[model samples]
Target: MHEVVAVRATIPGMTTTVDPRTVFETSGADLDAARAVFEQAYEASGFLPERTERVFGYRFRTVGDQTMSFRSTRFDARMVGEVDSGDQVSVSWVTDGGGVLDVGRDELGLSPGRPVVFPTGRPYRFELADVRQSVVQLDRTFLERIAAEAYGTEPGTLVFDHTAAPGVEAVRAWNHQVQEASRIVLGNAPVSVLALADTARRTALALLTTFPHRITARQVPLPTGATGRVRSAVEYMHAAAHTPITTTDVAEHVGLSVRGLQQAFQRQIGVAPNALLRGIRLDRVRDELRAGTPTDTTVASVAVRWGFAHLGRFSAAYARRFLEYPRDTLHG
Candidate 1:
């Protein structure tokens, strides 16, 4: 696949980078048309099925520079192709539908919420139908540096042995992050360079830790605790309530497995970590509503500011926690 070329201006002071962040979409019954679009977006080349193919939809939105970019693609029909064997690593998550990827004698079945990394320099053939996927593409060199520093695995030997999301907990976290990224990249809001960089780092870290890699076996499992780490986990939740986080992150922060953290919370605090986190967020929202006047703060704004995107759930949770509506607190 060819890198996107920048248009040079003859009038001076118009030279720019290759491809700026943009949303590209197209649809029709043309076979080659779809192939070309996907080829430019994903460095994959192959013929589309010549059967009764109806190209219902295909779209991709890209953000960031060549070092890393987050993209989302929607394929409404079957498309079989192979990627260029290059140094670009794609950590992909299938949000909907399913597909089969065959790479170097290994065949993988893709499903919703599961992330798989198509490592650099591997040419893989894919047969995907009606799939909506988000991909984080980064250079292999960047990943190698991260691997060497954090995982103690040298170049070429830091193999991502598995393509699974580890468990249900990891699936939830993965979906949340991928969907969040999709929203940002696809949305109309301007994405600053720093924001895109943060997104790339977070996505890379999640990809590395969620997928089983060669360093996994070398690292010894930290002992689990139910009592000692519960307070620490609670503190972490309270501190990071405004940010996007998961139970797995809390467990990792406290050197415990998710089950271990849950057991500890149950034993010491009489509630699970997630429940306590929700309560803490609810309290923060309530306090904000109480402190601000109705003209200064709206229930919706306050709720969303604290990462409560679903107004229905936020309202329900607020009522359960405070025995009164959030609006009441704002006006009272």
Candidate 2:
């Protein structure tokens, strides 16, 4: 199911009417009219709008097992130019078509799977290139608060880099899952709304933590009435460690910078980042070693399966940590 969320802001006796429709469809001039409506929505959201061209487009909104409206589209590549005077940050994930995004002075290529974020106060440009996107915007203050919580550092100091990092593949997978959940939330699954909202909140928190920063604070705030965001992030990593994992991805999932993420892990787990990752990999290897499976199983296969990128290095590391060669375990 397809879904969109539209929020509206209206001013009496204004030249424009803003209606943010989550899921809706239009065609011909009507499509252009909807684009205009979106432009108004952007303006109402405190963004300065530039000229935008109209193209055929479709949108849908949902709530429970119900969907509202749907339409198909065919148009020359359409574009919308936007600037937020208030300097809000937007965290967005693309569902279709790759594009080049220019945020301030940096230009980055965006593709399907991974999520990207940009600050809105500056001039930015994007060529969607037949792109379909699932996006959400956060107020600058809110983003700062979340970042501060993750880093245990000063707010408004986190700087996001759009480049991919280790475990990026894992992040992409999670992002797609969030997009699907978003679709359900906007489509028609009341049962999913709360879950999706919680997911959205967690995703936002994680993305913030992925921003690059130096360590300054020793302890970050935790979620109230629970171990908090940091614990949730650790659990997420432990649960998904067998999958390709990266510190940045985990940090973003928990809303901390690489340094902050490292600091948190060291404080809570008593080990460094790579150490923990290696331990996780080794633990999985040990489990396989003890399973007593077929004799044809090779140590190299087990190493690769646990994400050892190099067989020789994996063997040496395994011997160093376990005091036994992987081959010895495989043969024994």
Candidate 3:
């Protein structure tokens, strides 16, 4: 049976390091112990073994709220495994070994140089042989916050399409970013909270751009009539107000031409699409300024965070809306 022979070590800067050596036999007990190690690192599921009497090794490290893991087996053995990711998305790259992953209705071949993206709340199965891979687990809340900031709306049910492999250039870029993030999080260099936040935001944005998802406005169906179209467009704008999107993007998203979308909004919402977008962004900025700490955050930072580029205009609009200056709200 596999035995826990090592103690978990916690390093400075929120890092956890663990190296667990497991002995596998012909019994089910060893299998359970092996599965426990996987569960502790990522998600838990069944591991069906095709051979016996092998040693399994696992090395895990966590840095700045991200979990990284390396897993390998001593002997060549065919195995079937499944995992339910719960609320965390896992990005895995096969460093030295290869396998096949069955996600949803698609079976994808996993090999060196090809990275796999696993969305949260999805079940995936794998048939592995001598698999040695590194996995990074990103929290769902963190990703959703980044998405909301980028798209100007609450992103519901973020999905990653894993049916096909991403492009080579994209994979290389992501690998570079992942390595840089790891270095920043694990290295001895001092990192500020804002710097780390920026890195995380960039990484999350890159992932979203590289992978296709269901968050686009085009995926949303327009209602049966013009009023329905207007409603959909406004809802999309309100949700995406924080994003740097144009009226054209909004119109295309709701399946309308620019003129059509404008006419619909003017008739139904009594405001143009651009006006609605600006108003929503202003509201978001005001809310953040009111809720943020003045010591750690500034009015300019709050305005910039919500996509208000012109400081003078933003300040004037803030005063007009709340009957007080943005600085006053932040200080209070």
The best candidate by lDDT is 1
Which stretch of 10 consecutive residues in model 2 shows the poorest summed lDDT? 62-71
By lDDT, highest first, what's the ranking? 1, 3, 2
Clashes of each: 1, 25, 4
lDDT of 1 by residue, 85-113 (tens): 25466777787877887644577888886
TM-score of each: 0.51, 0.42, 0.51
TM-score of 2: 0.42
Q: Report how far off residue 320 is in candidate 1 (Å).
A: 81
What is candidate 2's local distance difference test score?
A: 0.53
lDDT of 3 by residue, 47-164 (tens): 7655534454433334453422222233244567776555566677776667777634478887877778863333567777666666655665577667778888865546677765
Instruction: For candidate 2, write residues 227-261 as lDDT tens digits.
Output: 22345454555667788988777776654578976
TM-score of model 3 (CA atoms)? 0.51
Model 1: what TM-score?
A: 0.51
lDDT of candidate 3?
0.63
Query: Which residue pairs show backbone clashes in model 1?
Result: 226-264
Please identify which of the two predictions, 1 or 2, would achieve the higher lDDT against the true structure.
1
Give me the displacement of residue 101 in model 2, in angstroms: 1.6
